[model samples]
Every structure is written in C-alpha cells, then in structure tokens.
Target: MSTVGRPPGRGTDEPVGDLVSRASQQISALVREEMRLARAEMTQKGKRFGMGGGLFGGAGLIGFLAAQASAAAVIAALALLLPVWASALITAALLAAVAAAMAAAGRRQVAEAGTPAPQQAIDSVKADVTEIKEATHR
Candidate 1:
C-alpha cells in the first residue's frame, strides 16, 4: 500500500530556529484573535449604552410634551383663585424641581454603565503571556 501523505522532511527533532519561528507565528495569531474578540465585546456593550440613551431621549421628549400640557392646566386652574403670574411661577418652580431630580437619576444610570474595557480579553492575554514565559524557560 502507498503512503497517503508526503514523506516527513526531518524526523522528530526540529531546529531551534524553526521552533522559535513557529512559536512567534502562533503567538502573533493568538494576539490577533484576542484583539478581535475584545473589539467585538466592547462593541456589544457600546450598542446597549447607545440604545438606552436613545430610549431615554425619546421618553424625555414625550414627557416634556405631557408636562407642558399638565402645567398649563394646573396654572389655569390655580389662576382662578390667585394672580395669573403667581400661578405660572409656582408651576414653573415645581417643573424645574422635577427636571433636576430626573437629571440626577439619569446621570447615575449612565455612570453605572462603567468602563467598556475588555477585561476578560486582558486577563486571558495575561495568562497566555505567563504560560509562554514558562514554556520558553523550560
């Protein structure tokens, strides 16, 4: 029966230079793959952040319209008992206070989004480096 593959060049023992070159190529490929993975992870997180922010903006727009209608109604009703300007001022002050509170809460939510760094990729790279060092030393 004929052998299936090409005959092996040099039996078992590979040259030091050839071994080092192969190791270098492998390490380079591994680093590239890790970087690609990290980019993908960060991109996913960024999309979520963007989506949340967009939703918040849409909600703010709708809320603004609702508040405007409500404030006008309140001012008109209050104006029946008090001066028009006074009713308007009171309504404005209440709306301003609510806006301030909402702003603070939104800021906290955004801040909680945290850093987008690829922590898993970083740790994996660190472990790979350590393993390479140990192998090289041996």
Candidate 2:
C-alpha cells in the first residue's frame, strides 16, 4: 500500500539513483513506524504513571493525616499518666516503620519500570543508523 517504496522512473527504466531514492523512502517509512510505536508505548505508560501518581498522592495525604492524629493521641496519652518520652518514642518508631515500608515499595516500582524511554530510543536509533548505512553502501 506504499508507493514510496517504488523506485523512481519505474516504467521508464530507472537508474541507480532511483533505486537509492526508493531505498531511502523505505528507510524513512521504517523510522517513522518505529518512532510511532515508541511514542504510543510511552504514552500508554505515561497515562498509567499519571494515575498511579494520583493514587499515591491521595494515599500520602491520608497517611499524613493519620500520623498527625497519632501525634495528638500520643500527647493525650502523655497528659493522662503515660510517660511523655515513651509516647513520643512509640510514635517515632511507628512513623519510621511506615517510612521504611513506603521507601521499599517505591524502590521496587522504580526498578520494575526500568529504563523504558532512553533504552528503547537508543536501540531504535541504532537500528535506523545500521539500516541507513547498509542502504547507502548498496
């Protein structure tokens, strides 16, 4: 369905230049397709990433409120006969545990995502360069 791959002056007995032009056009089309594929892949990932970030933000907001409420509870417990430092120490430990869990989860997500954009772009560019070089030499 692509006329671009047809050598120039096809019916008129084309020369080598026509062949080169056709090759170039085919290479161009291949590059465009690769680029389109890359963009679509990244766009889909970006949308999922956006949604995940929104959910994370909402969760973070709720967690912050809960921590604040815990701090208030700690203060009330201290006022009612619980030792102040003991309450604060317990709250601090709880916050540290939560922070460690969140950090570990975030790191796992980052590792799973890998180098999506840059690695794909690099591979595609390398392929295009190799194709162009071969086309030119032929």
Candidate 3:
C-alpha cells in the first residue's frame, strides 16, 4: 500500500547533493512556517490587548459616571450643614480627582503597550533578510 503523504522520491536512495538541496528547501519552508506562526501570535496578542483595554475603558467609564453621581449625592447630603460654595467645591474636586486617576491609568497602559508597530516591523525585517539570503545564494 502506498502512503498518501510521502512522495515516491522520499523512499529513494538519492545523491548527497540532492539530500542537501532538499534539506535547504525544508529549512526555508520551516522559516516560512515560523514567520507565519509569529505573525499569528502577534495578531492574537494584539487582539487580547485591544479587548482588555476596551473592557477596562468601559468599566472606567461606568465607574466615572457612578463616581460623579455619588459625589453629587454626597454634596447634597453635606449641603444641609455646609455653605453652598463649599459643597460644590468639594464635589467638583472629587470628580476632578477621579477623572485624573482614570486618565493616568489609561496613559500608563498605553505606554506599556508601546505599539505593535515595533514588533511587526522587526518581523518584516527578519523575513526580508531570509528572502535576501536565499536570493543571494541562488
């Protein structure tokens, strides 16, 4: 019975040069496959980063709204005992603090990401180098 995946030549006793050339071809194929895997991995990482950041931003938005409402409620509660200006000032400060905190967290996360641009650029250069090597020797 013939094996479906094996080429007939794979079963042959071939010349050493033929084996070497075939090995080179296989190496090239392996590199191509590795490049593909890396691309896929980076894409998945980017997707996860986006999804996580989006979720975080969404939560932050909800929290911001809740914070503002709660601050207003606190101000109203305090208005009974405090001057109008003092109550408004305290609530405004609380809201500003919350906004600043969220902004800082977002900025830090964006900085940590530092963009996928560098990773993709490096992979492209590696692939180009591989191609050039094959071309030069041929």
Candidate 4:
C-alpha cells in the first residue's frame, strides 16, 4: 500500500515516527505564522497609539501657549484698560478651547485604539488549538 499521493498519517503503511515528525513540523510552522501575525498586529496598534500620544503632546504645547497669552493679556489689562487687552483675552480663550478640543479628540482616539493585545491573533490561535484538539480526538 503505497501512500505517496495521500496526506501524512492517513496512510496505513506509513511509520508512526514519520507521522509524528510531520505533525510536529506543521505545528511549528503554524506557531511561527501566528507569531508573525501577532507581531504585525501589535506594530499597527503601536503606531495608532503613537499618533494619539503625539496629538496629546501637541495639545499640551498649545495649552502652554494659551497660558502665556493669558498672562500677557492680564498684564495688558492691568497696565492699560484698552480694547487690545480684551482682544488678547479673547484670543487666549480661543486657544485654550482649541487645546481642550484637541485633547478630547486625542483621548477618544486612544480609547478607540484599544489595548495593545493582539486580539485577532489570540482568537486565531485559540481556534487553531480547538481544531487541533478536535482532530486529535477524532
């Protein structure tokens, strides 16, 4: 009973050692592929997190500038109660509002990006394990 055309372990003539070796090799390949997928997924999520963090940094810088402008506005208002100080105050307020909005957006982005875990890869690995177990039982 030549089993050259059939899959491994399916042939009655093949040695048990050969079947085990093939199964181990296939399992190793599957694990490597799953690990690669996990790494890629993590890298993508990391990029999203980096972008969100950058937005937060930008918001902080803007907030600092608004604070400086507010200080200048207060000084102008105290030194000379003119329309210029009022305009400065308005500008500072607008900047501060913009910073707040940016910060909120960044927070939302980070939240939506989710945890750094490779959820898809985990699910795939779990499914693969289930399939292998079922196959072994059969």
Best by TM-score: 3
Off by over 4 Å in 4: 1-9, 81-138
* Clashing pairs for predicted structure model 3, backbone only: none
**Candidate 2 clashes between residue pairs 3 or more apart in a chain or in different chains:** none
**Candidate 4's residue-wise lDDT over 1-138, tens digit each?**
677988776757679998899999999999999999999999999999999999999999999999788778675765575577666767678778998999999999999999989999999999999999999999
- Give candidate 3's whole-model lDDT: 0.90
Q: lDDT value for candidate 1?
A: 0.91
Which 10 consecutive positions of candidate 2 have the poorest summed lDDT?
A: 5-14
Q: For model 3, what is the error of residue 72's alpha carbon versus the real structure, in angstroms, after optimal superposition?
A: 0.8
TM-score of each: 0.51, 0.48, 0.52, 0.50
TM-score of 3: 0.52
Where is model 4 poorest over a 10-residue stretch in terms of lDDT?
A: 73-82
Which one wins by TM-score: 1 or 2?
1
Alpha-carbon runs more than 4 Å astray in model 2:
1-14, 82-138
Model 1 clashing-pair count: 0
Model 1 worst lDDT run, 10 consecutive residues = 2-11
What are the clashing pairs of model 4?
A: none
